[model samples]
Target: MNAVLIALLALPLLGAALMLAPIGDRQALRLGATVTGGTLLLAVALAAGFDHGDPGRMQAVTDVSWIPALDVRLHLGTDGISLPLLVLTALLTFLCALYSVKKLPAGPGGRAFTGLLLLLETGMLATFAVLDLVLFFLAFEIVLIPMYFLVSRWGSGKKTAAANRFILYTLLGSAVMLLGFLLIGVKAGTFDMVKLADAHGAGLSHTTQLVAALAVLVGLAVKAPAWPLHSWLPDAHTAAPTVGSVLLAGVMLKMGTYGLVRVLLPVVPDGTATFAPYLGAFAAVGIVYGSLACLALARAGAKGDLKRLIAYSSVGHMGFVLLGIASLTPTGLNGALFANIAHGLITGLLFFVVGAVKDRYGTADLDTLSGATGAALYGRAPRIGALLAFAAVASLGLPGLAGFWGELLAMYGAFDPAAGLSRPAFVTYMVLAGLGTLLTAGYLLIVVKRVCMGDPKQPAPVAELPDLQAHEAVSWTPLAALTLLAGLWPALLLGLSDPAVKHLLGGG
Candidate 1:
């Protein structure tokens, strides 16, 4: 069974290799889709075989020595915490592949882009599963290379500059993170995460624990792209292709928060206790700041620009996920996970729609896209327009949608933190985050009102316009349906996450 975990990562890499061997063939795209779907099916197998009754313990453990002297080993497995994220990585990759079937433009190097995407999924899945710090870091950094190529080679709008900036920011943080990981390893005398987390910082002094925690925070913060460190995300997201944007927002961002939860909290419980207040503060600030930024983007779109508006919206949505994590309570962690998955589904759908709009309209300028003329699908493409409207509503955290629970739960967590957290400050934070909901609703509605309501006054030449096709429907419905289902019955995820949350909180 443990071997199944190893196979989850290996299968994708093998599939990527096979598909790339005959890269230029017509079936290459289908092969890539098949392989990615297979990886997802493998994840489903794990979910079914998993003993959900006891979610705290790592199930199906695989351990072997890779570096005897430093005591690193090829340790990989799952707990309830890692399971949802792993499954997310699998589902997103498969849907993204399916989405790309007819959607992505075939540049000269088309096959390579598809291959790198598959490889990237393998890297992300492996990083989540590996239990040794060294193995974890390897898988983590391996993902960066492929994504860099994915964006630099295939992305749009100042691709060279965006990719270089992305590489510079991420590499710097990775170095710092490695230093922090090394400090932990050197001090604790091993790289096995389960053992070290169990040791609880291995008796490090309180001050040392705080410093290590800060180091880990700085490293993951870069990836989380929290308020101050978040400058790189917009350009990278704005310029990247639709597939890159989807995976970046949906799966890659989770890497940082996941690190905070899986590594920082457990290894440096003392430091987490000391720094939780500051974490909450930053999360609250990011929420407000990101909300304002969204309004500004809406303002920019009101002037007629397109991609930048959607890119800015990503910042605001992810703010909820960050704020949820900073709450430091059972409800907060679950809210954060809920937001993580919900945002991935909604925002990924948002990007896909944006991409389709760009493809048909020749520009994404809000004012110009009246949708009444040639692009006017309200009468012609009412279903497409309606679907877009539904996604926008869900994204704004409308009641009975997937996005609602996360923000609501985050507020719940902030209002009443765990025993040791700062109650008064988080209470204030809760009020502010709730206010952010109005701001979220504003921009999303502005998007719908501006783009979907009026008749297409100035036709976007028919040559440029086409409605949503069959394959796109195949890719889109599951995500939208899940978003609605989760919203209606929040228990599906809440029930799954409860035991894991209890374990993380040192028992509920």
Candidate 2:
């Protein structure tokens, strides 16, 4: 088990290293796909071997002392909580690699692009695997460098500025988070996540725990980019290339929310209780804010970029996740976890479709691409249009899709919060969140009507353009299928998470 886990981390690094060996672009692409594919297989094996009945306990643990003086160990493990994310990281990275095989970003360094992607995969996988706070922090920070390079080097307009903003915001957040970790580490005399969470910061004074929790929550909220802090996301997504947007929305955003469930709630229960109401408020506000932003952009006629609008939609989806976390009930946490995976599949697919739109039409301009106004995309590229509509509907939380359960359950949690929480406050949040759902439906339907429904105003040259290329079909089919499968069988993911969440919340 230990060997398999180590191999999962090592394979990506090895692939990255090989990219430096004077490899040609074709070979580099091949190597990237091969490495990520292998990693995905390993992730699957890990899941197959997981003891689902005992998922509350970490499985395949590999613990060894690495820094004796500091009481930090080289611990790696996964529970039901981390397993889904682990698989998500592997699956998305592999798909990105496959997508790059034919549609490599317009950049000079194909080798560097593939290499950095592999490295990014390593950091993401490691972040979920590590069970030591210090090691987790290290793995968490490792992803920033490669992603910064990815955005700055390969992105479009104002890429450098966007990259700088992303780095500044995340680095500051991470620094504050580190301080919180250090405070708990010093007080507990160890950085083992399992021990710290089990203790629930019992060793620290109430005031100390509260202070540390504030610092940690603030830091994570920034990464989660809850409301005011989320300004960086739009620009970053707008400037980023297709694959960058896919991974950023699909995998990176989950890191902050994952920390909330994995680190904050368990390690500092008192702190989480103290701040839960306020967290719920912020989440509710973000939901409305994100939806309104999308509506305003949609109203902007030809000026709005589809990619940026999708980025705003992400903020709204994440608000549901945050609301679930703030509820701090087993049902809420389950919803949050389910939403995490659903967002990855649905939004990742959305980004891919948007990227293809831009690639084929030279822009993701709504008025220009809208079938009602310009190209009549459904008539020109029927397959791409159909796929885009499917992704958008799923994202809007349509019935019988992956996005439905999470939002529905989250609202339910807010309606009936945990035992100790304030009922009035959560009910208010529930109402607000319910309204946000209406807004979500409104904006998405508007987009669909404009882009997919109307007759061709000025039909694009069908012969020159293509719809759902071979590589794209290969990369997208699994996500589309899973969205339906999980929707129909919510238990597939919910079952895995319920026991673990129950254990965390002391329901066991």
Candidate 3:
């Protein structure tokens, strides 16, 4: 098991290193696809071996004293919480690599691009796998360089500025978060996350715990980009390449919320309780704020970019994730965890479809996409248009789809928060979040109608546009299938998470 886990982290890094050699673009793509695919297979094997009956306990652990002087260990493990994310990272990266095979990004060095993506994959997997605070932090920071380069080098307009903003904001957050980790490590006499969470910060003074929690939450929030701090996301998403957008939305953003469940609530329960109300308030505000931003952008007509609009919608979806975490109940946390995966699939597909649209038309501008006066998509490419509409519907939290349960369960969590939280406030948040849901449906429906309905104002061109290509269908079908599968049977994710959440909340 330990060897399997080590291989999971190592394969990608090794592939990345190999890509730096004089490999051809085809070789690099093959290498990347093989490595990521292997990682996914390993992840599936790990899942199969996982002791589902004991989902709450960390399984397949690999612990070794890496730096005794600093009390930092080369500790890695997974439970239901981490396992889902690990698999998600592997699956998305694999799909990205698969996509690249048919459609390599236009650049001088496709090898370098593929290599950086692999490196990013390794970092994300490590972040979810490591069980030590210092190790986790190190893994957490490793992704910055690759992602910054990906955005700056491979992205579209304003890519450099967007990458710089992303790096600056996240780096600052990481610095503060590191200080909190060190504080807890020094005060608690260890940096093992599992141990610290088990202790629940019992050894630290109340003030110390509060301060550390504040710092850590602030840092994580920047990644979560939760309201007021989410300014970087829109620009980054708008500028990033399609694969970058997919990974950013799919797995990277979840690190923050995952930290909340795996690190914050367990290691600083009292502090989490102390800050729950404020977190809920911020999350509620984000929900409405993101929805309004989307609505405003949709109304912007030609000025509105579909990718950017989707980016804003992410903020709203993550707001529900945060709101669920704030509820601090097993149901709420489970919903948050479940929502994390759901968003990954739904948003990843959305980015892919949008990327295809941009590729076909050279622009994702609403007015341009709508043709002179009517929706040009269906007329231009019916299959792509249909896929886009399906993704939009799924994203709008339609029932019997993956998106529905997360939002539904989150609202349920907010309506009846765990003990110690003020019910009236949560109830108020619940009401507001519900309103935000309506706004979400409204904007998404408008987007679909504008982009996928009606005839083109002009006659169809003599050259027929391509529909969903083989690679696009291959890359997108699984996400679509899973969206429906999980929607109809949420237990696929919720069951995996519920026991772990119960354990984290001390129910066991």
Candidate 4:
């Protein structure tokens, strides 16, 4: 079991290291696909062997002393909370790698790009696996440089600025978060997350918990891009390349929210309690704001950049995730966990579809792609249009798709909240989130109507545009199928998470 966990981290790192050798474009692509494919298989095996009957306990733990003087250890493990995210990280990376094999945005697509992607994969996988605060922080920071390079080097419009803002904002947040982690470690006399969670703030004073929680939450929120802190996301997502966008939306944002549930909620329950109301308020604001922003973009027609609009939608989607975490109820946490995985699949597919659109039309501007009457997509490429529509509806939380269950469960959690939380406040948040969903449906439906329902102004040229490519079909099918599967059978995720959420919250 430990070997599986170790290999989960090592295979990608080794693949990345091997990428440093002189490799051609095709070789690099194949290598990346092969490595990520193996990683995905390992993740599946991890899930297969996971003690679902005892998901509350961390399994596949790999603990050893890495630095004796400081008592830091190379600790790693997973529970239901982390396991889904681990698999999600692997699955998305593998899909992206497969996509890259045939399609890379116009840039140097060989060794450097593939290597950075593998390195990024290593960090993300490690972030979910590590059980030591020091190691967790290290894993958290490891992704920044590679992602930065990917955006700046391979991305399109405003790439440099986007990458710069991403690095700067996240780096500042990480610095603050590290200080908080050190504070917790020093005061608690240990850095083991499992132990800290078990103690549940027993050794720490309220003041210390309060202070540390603020620092850590602020840092993680920046990554979560909660409310005002989310300014970097739209530009970053819009500017990043296709695979970059997929990975960013699909996997990276969850890191912040995952930290909230796994570390903040479990390790500093009191502090999280104190901040829950404010967090819920901010999350509520983000939900309405993101929906409204996407609504405006949707109405803008040609002026709207599809990629940027989807990025804003992420803000709203992640807001629901935050709202769930802030609720601090078993149902809410379960909802958060489920929402995390759903967003990864649905949004991943959305970006992939958008990437395909951009690849065909050379732009993601709604008007350019949609044509004068706002209906070139279906005419030009019916299959791709349908794919886009499917992804959009799924993202809007349609009833039978992956996106529906998470938001629904999250709202259900907010309706009652936890014992200590203000029911009235949470109910208000819930109301606003519900409104956000309506607005979400409005915008997404408008997008589908405008882009996929109308006829093309220039039928000849539009009809000449290609439909879904083989690589795209291969890359997108799993996400689409899983979205429907999870939506129709939400218990698949909820069951795995419920016990873990209970245990994290002291087995309530």
Candidate 5:
């Protein structure tokens, strides 16, 4: 079991190395992604083997002394909370890699991009698994480096400037976050997250605790790229390569939401209560703002802003997670956790489709792209168009697909918050958020009409091509299946998360 834990973390690192090897063939890069996916299958086995009745506690426990003199240890395990995110990280990483098979740049430039993505995948697994705070922070930081390079080097248009902007903003936030970690370690005399969460801020003064909480929020909000701080995301997403866009949307942003759950809420419950409304306000604005921006972009018919549109979609989806968290109810918490995976899967699929469209049509502009959706065009690429529709509609929280419950449950929880939360305030937020959901529906359907409706027409006349190739079929079909599975049977996810939520809420 310990060995399995280690393998789960190591597999992608090894995959990254193999892809970067001098062999230098695009086929080999793609093959490497498939091989890495095999590790995810191993994770699925772990998930199946999990003892469902006892899913709350860490299972498949593995601990090793790494820096005992300082009380640091290499510890990794999964509870209900970590399980879904881990699975999502693996699924999206695999799909992102698969997407790379077709989405990469024309030459040697593509090779390094694949390697960095694999490394990012490995880091995400480690960050989600590590139980120790210092280790978690370290693993968390590891996810940033490769992604910075992925954006700066292989990114498009404003790649260097965008990457620099992303890094600078995150670094500023991370500095404050690191200070928060050190404060916890100093006050609690341990760097273990379990130890600290178990302590529940008992060792620190109110002022001290609040300061640390704010510091951590600064860093995490930058990553969550919350309102005012979210400027970095549009640039990064627009400039990033397709696979980078996939990983960034699918898993990296979730890191911030996860941190809020893992660190701020548990470690500083009072601080969280004080700041919850403020956080919710930022999130609400991001939702309305992101959705509106996408509509404007689509309306203006800009060719290059397509990926940015999807990026804004992320802002809107994450707002739901924030809403759920702010509600401070088990249902909302569980819903947010589920949405993390749902959004990752759905948005990852969206980027894949957007990438494919750009590859085929050379642009993502709605006006310019009108004829591409004609019936004959669908005849030519029905699979891709259908998949895009699936992703876009699901993103709008379509009832039967993977995206349904987060907003519904978030509002439910808002109306009936846990005993500690302010009911009236949260209810108001919930009502406003519900209205935002309607707006979300509006924009997503617009994208659907623009991209998937018209009869087929050749923009200027060109050779015909087939829908999703074998690799795409492999990557997208399973996500679609899981989306449907979770949509129909949310119990598959809520069951795992409920216990963990219970523990976290009780100040675990």
Candidate 6:
């Protein structure tokens, strides 16, 4: 089992190295698909063998001294909190790799694209798997390089500027986060996450925890792209290729929220308790802000870019995730984890569908897509239109979909936050979050109406648009299916995460 964990990390790195050898573009793509597919199988195996009875226990752990002098170890493991995200990373990467095989982005062939993607996978998987703070930071930072290249090289509009902004903002965040980690390591006497979490701020002073929490949370908020810090996401997502956008929304943003749960909460209980209200406040603001932004985009019609609207929607969705964490309760944490996975699937599929639309029409503008008049898509491409509508409904938190449970649980948790947090503040946040949901439904329904419900009276070029293709179907079906499955059986994820959440909040 330990070997399985190591292989999960090493396999993709090895495959990416092999991609550098002289090979045909087609062969490179095939190799990428095979490699990521194998990685996904390994993730499934880990899940199958995971001890559901003790989901809180770290399984398949690989701990060894990497720097004896500094007491830093090369530690890797997964608990219920991380297991779902690990599998999600693997599944999405494999699907993206498979999708790229058929629909390689322009400006680069299979070699550059596949290699960068595989490397990005390695970073993302390691971020969810590592147990040492130093190792975690390193893994988190490794993702930037490949992603920067992906956007600048293969992206569409303002690619260079977007990539530069993305890297600069995240790098600054990483720097501040590293400062927090160093403060903890120097004061706490070690950098091992397990030890720190077990101690639960025993040795650290109240002041240290407060400062560390502020710095760490700020850094992560930048990546979570929380309200004020989220300016980079829209441009980056709009410019990136389909696979790039999928991985960015589906996996990368989770790194920030995951760090909050896996590192901040247990490791800095005092700070988390003190700042819980503020976190909830900011989360509420982000929720409303993101929804309003999307509403503006949806109403833009021809001026709107579907990809950009989806990017704004992520801010609102991730706000719910942060809100869950802020509640600092077991149910809230579970909701955060559940929302993380749900967003990955629904948003990944949405990006894929939008990417397909852009491929057909050469733009994602609503009016141009539907025609100068209304109701052009249903006539031109019923399948794509239907897929868009389905994804939109799933994203809007419909009762029987994956999105509903998480937001519901998050708001419920806010209605009753942890013992020390102020009830009034949280209740206010809850009310605002609920309003954000209504706004969310409004914008998404607007999108469905404008993009999918139009008549079949489109012009000749619009009529010529192709329906969903085989490769697109293969890549997108799993996400749609899992969205429905998880929606109907919320316990599939809640079961794995509930115990772990309890243990984390209970101080191990």
TM-score to true structure, per model: 0.95, 0.98, 0.98, 0.98, 0.94, 0.99
Candidate 5 segments exceeding 4 Å error? 18-21, 27-31, 300-304, 371-380, 458-465
Kindly report which residue stretches of model 4 are placed more than 4 angstroms away from their true locations once superposed. 457-463
Off by over 4 Å in 1: 19-22, 300-305, 371-377, 461-464
Off by over 4 Å in 2: 300-302, 371-374, 457-463
As a TM-score, model 4 comes out at 0.98
Residue pairs clashing in model 6 are 375-454, 375-455
lDDT of 2 at 159: 95
Q: lDDT values of the candidates?
A: 0.79, 0.89, 0.90, 0.92, 0.80, 0.92
Q: Estimate, for each residue in 1-508, the C-alpha lDDT of model 5 and write its tens digit.
A: 5567678888878877787567665766676577567868868877888889977788888888889888888888888998889888888888777767765655346567777777898888898889887887888788888989988887778788999998888888888899998888888788877767777777877887888888888889888868778889999998887878888988989999998888887787777777787887787777788788787776633552678888887888898888888776789888888888898888888887787777777665566666455423355678887888888888889898778887778778778877766778777778777777888888777777777666564553336656788877887787888888888998998999999888887865
Global Cα lDDT for candidate 5: 0.80
Per residue, candidate 4 scores C-alpha lDDT tens digits across 15-108 of 9999889879889989999999999999999999999999899899888999999999999899888998999999999999999989876777
Model 4 RMSD, rounded to 1 decimal: 1.2
Give the range where candidate 3 is weakest over 10 consecutive residues by summed lDDT: 456-465
Candidate 1 lDDT tens digits, 89-191:
9998998888777776545465787778888999899888999988888887988988898888888778879888888888888888888788888877788
Specify the highest-lDDT model's number. Answer: 6
lDDT of 6 by residue, 308-388 (tens): 999999999999999999999987888888999999999999999999989987888776665545545566778888888
Per-candidate clash tally: 5, 0, 0, 1, 6, 2
Off by over 4 Å in 6: 300-302, 460-463
Cα deviation at 300, candidate 3, in Å, is 5.3
